[model samples]
Target chain A: MPDTPFIDDGSNVPLSELRWPDDDLTRIPDWIYTSDEVFQRERERIFFGESWCFVALEAEIPEPGSFKRSYVGDVPVIVTRDEDGDIHVFENRCAHRGAEFCRALRGKAENFTCPYHQWMYDLKGKLMAVPFRRGDHGEGGMPKDFKLEDHNPKSLNVTTRHGVVFASFSESVESLEEYLGPENLEQFDVVFKGRKLKILGFYKNRLQGNWKLYHENLKDPYHATLLHVYLATFRLMVAGQKSAMICDESGRHSTMASAKDDNIEIGEETASQMKSAFREGMELNDPDFLNYVQEFDSPWTVTMQIIWPNLVVQRELNTLGIRHIVPRGPHALDMYWTMFGYEDDTPELERQRMKQGNLMGPSGYLGVDDNEAIKYLQDGFKHSHSQEGIVKLEPEKEGSTETLISEASVRALYRHYRQVMDI
Target chain B: MASTHPAGTNLSPEEARALRFEIEEFNTEYARILDEQDIDFWPDFFTADGFYRVTAKENHDEGLPVGLVWCDGRPMMQDRAAAVKTTMVHAPRYLRHYNSNVRVTGVDTDGTIHSESNYLVIETLMEQESRIFQAGLYIDQFVREDGVLRLKARDCIYDSLLIPNDMVYPV
Candidate 1:
């Protein structure tokens, strides 16, 4: 008999059929963005394997019994705070018939009862009771020894740092601090420094592109100079600014940091290079929208951290938020944006934050450009006969660089991606 | 047209009908300008200190202060209009606004009118079918400037939770 390959899902294409176009880190094959086999493997190896995916913020479910619907990969999960004030993460599927019982996006619940079969579960995801377990006056009761504990829904290993929540499917996943190494942790702490967070609101939008494109967009500072006119015109981030793309040793996480310079003038050569982005007479009618209140101790005015696979922590001047990427398929993804502020922020600061929010989200001055570019990339890959997309700018470098003309962070991401996917 | 009616006096049946007709005419012109893609003139529909915000129904219900498109004054709106017109890059599309159920909820002592209207926006991208983009309620406060109704505040609370890609233009 022939040796059968392991195929967990019946619809997934075999892994042997997919191939990388070349071994070079500068060239990315289009199949990685359009293959179902690769997507399934990524789900198995990265999102569901040894990765601590960010699920929710502690401020979202601040009180006992407060629950929010979230996702680990594409699978649905529930993040809850029990009566003991301990956080728990469990699959939303009912243990009896595999029904997604918790329907609301978020709410406070004492206990969950599956509407299909009436199987009840506690806040900790323990099976508390079952309707008609004795089956109508003992006519047809449960078999001899059925244990309530055995039928509990599958739960995950939950951990939190500062106020951010993360969940993992692996039992022996490393500590959150160790996962985000010392260098990455230093930048992470700049935003989450033990102060209470007050969530302002949310912005949800669906993009017609793969989920990883978002990470690439943040990592590739090459695009920030030419693509976003608002960033370039307003001098929020330009080519000659003090910027660094800091990637961790594992290459899975990165922080693209840049400081704003009000007095810096664009040189002739640099101005010629960014002709489309930098306008000569462009000025804001409301200059207060560009006000940068110095709140953080860090020197960087913008620190966009891509925390591997699923989360993006955004600190763009005074505006602060976290973007949770949920992959729908190979070609589509949904972004859930949670815009927040600190509890001690004054009314003026809050209003400032709100005004500066025009630079972000789906309809933002800078954000819309990226979304359109990603969509165009996806359309090109899907419709054309191109086999590979080039990422060869500053080709000699790999992890981090000081120049804005490099794709070192993007190349670093692919290097890590190739190892994990075993391509 | 001078009248014997006091500032806080209730309008007669004929007066209420005339006021509704005038407000509807204003809304029709507003929609026509937006649908025609004359965005430079969009800010002129509001007073100098008018406020405009577009937020989800969920956030409005929860009393969340954030807005998808938050403009505190006409200057901010003008800035947004300029960005969307000249700087921001987005796919070209056409949007048509359909507003109905215009109701004059109340009238203040200073002749400021508070009204509500249901709105629907249908969008058509290049070489794509026209689809419903957003459906919402416009909670508005209008005050006359030189006998012309100008929006003092327009709060667009959308029912669609997940916006498709981007909403480049104002609602």
Candidate 2:
């Protein structure tokens, strides 16, 4: 928890600090959120390791020579589409002195030139040229054998599916499809659906909690009803709603789906108990704003999908979007949320998406709760730092379940996380 | 975008001075209620049929329709207030809103005032030092409803691309 500079070499830190509970994924150590060794090891073992991380959307750089800057863990990356119409991702760091070559969020450029010393790279991240390669005024220059090809920035193995792009630092990592697993991919295909995407805009928020908590926040459905009164207030999500947690075989990828049941039936026992927590006299004068237009064939009104390490494809009743996690260090992370709708959406649909969007961003009806809960976690994890936090809501299983009230999904996420992290 | 004088330049010096006084007074009262965390009175500052949005300057410049906080009418604004009270779970913090560089850009045909002001909110959370929560431009349109200035449209375009943690309340 002390001030520690980001060091890639975890060997320097004590092994005692990076220790996890004796139990497999049942108990997560608080130190994982604050340990410098774990944070550094994760960069290499999980992020730069064999795990395929979601870097960017292929739709973001649809045009030839279009590029968008992203990050794989803390390491900056550039996702670009070359003139040949191939999508590629490479380290944003310049080969020369490691300066970030691309500064803009997105732009069209045939070449990415590092401003530090004008070291240029092609769209595929192949180092093209270096200024003064052959000495300027016949004085001094590069050695006759100084090859431009030798200085190419590190590039990731890239793949695109359903308009989303996944990149892996390790060429040996499983293909995007294999890594995402068939079950989770099915839910992903639901949001993407081969339709052209229209990017509404981005809402980036810097959080005080570790990035993993945000991932856990999405995967954990038990907190939804308790934390977000808006969901229950509007009957969007209830205590015992018709829902299912469809987790992938690997327990890495998952989708927590909750269907909105119009045919009301809450037993009196549950009703009286929940009524105490539900906000009374609360009414939406414009109920049309929260109304779901039934865009997807699936009866789910709320779906939070986690494609591990970063990508969170969320479908919160017409507000379809992706929340990309950017982990800064042990205690902080920045969330880059791209709120969008399908290209073929009508004006009415667009309005619906915009109106519903207020339910998810940092200021949304539901989002505000998460922002607070995670910070409270960080605060707890920091000061009174517990050795292990409980996640036994649905103890019988850890991957998938039918109950909306369970921590099984989050427990599954950690189960997969530990496999990769080896904490 | 900064507002340019549309009709204020044509006003008599006396009339302009009086308008400036009235507008400044309204902004002061608005800031006080917000800083005090008076959510109930927040919507009262606007007309029944008003538009309020919190967005980034990048989106504003591009004319993007999306906003961080978008409320079409007083009902929605009231909902926002009610949500903060009932459902919203955010760290309690003290927000001090400072509005300055107030300018009445123009006067509409029916006496609607188009104005712009720069605002900075300093947030002090429990046991944490006060920090710059948000700094932005308030692009506004005000109309006299019953001889009192009520905000018709308030577009708070924050220049910072990233908001800290989460925005519990409006800017």
Which candidate has the top score in lDDT? 1
Candidate 1 residue runs with Cα over 4 Å from true position: A1-14, B1-16
TM-score of chain A of each: 0.95, 0.94
Q: Model 1, range A1-423, lDDT digits (tens) per residue?
A: 111234222224456876676588888987787778788888999889999999999999999999999999888999999999999999999999899999998889999999998899999999999877877876886775988999999999999999999999999989999999887899999999867999999889989788899989999999999998888888998999999998888888999999999988989898899988888779999988998999998999999999988999999999999999998777778999999999999999999999989999988998899899998887776666647888989977898888889998898999899998999
What are the clashing pairs of model 2?
A135-A141
> Candidate 2, residues A171-195: lDDT per residue as tens digits?
8988887888888878888888768
Global lDDT scores for all candidate models = 0.89, 0.83
> What's the TM-score of each model vs. the native?
0.95, 0.93
Model 1 clash pairs? none
TM-score of chain A of 2: 0.94
What does the lDDT read for residue A69 in candidate 2? 88
Residue B99 of model 1 has an lDDT of: 89
Candidate closest to the true structure, highest TM-score: 1
For candidate 2, give the lDDT of residue A31: 77
Task: For model 2, state the Cα shift of residue B59 in Å.
Answer: 1.7
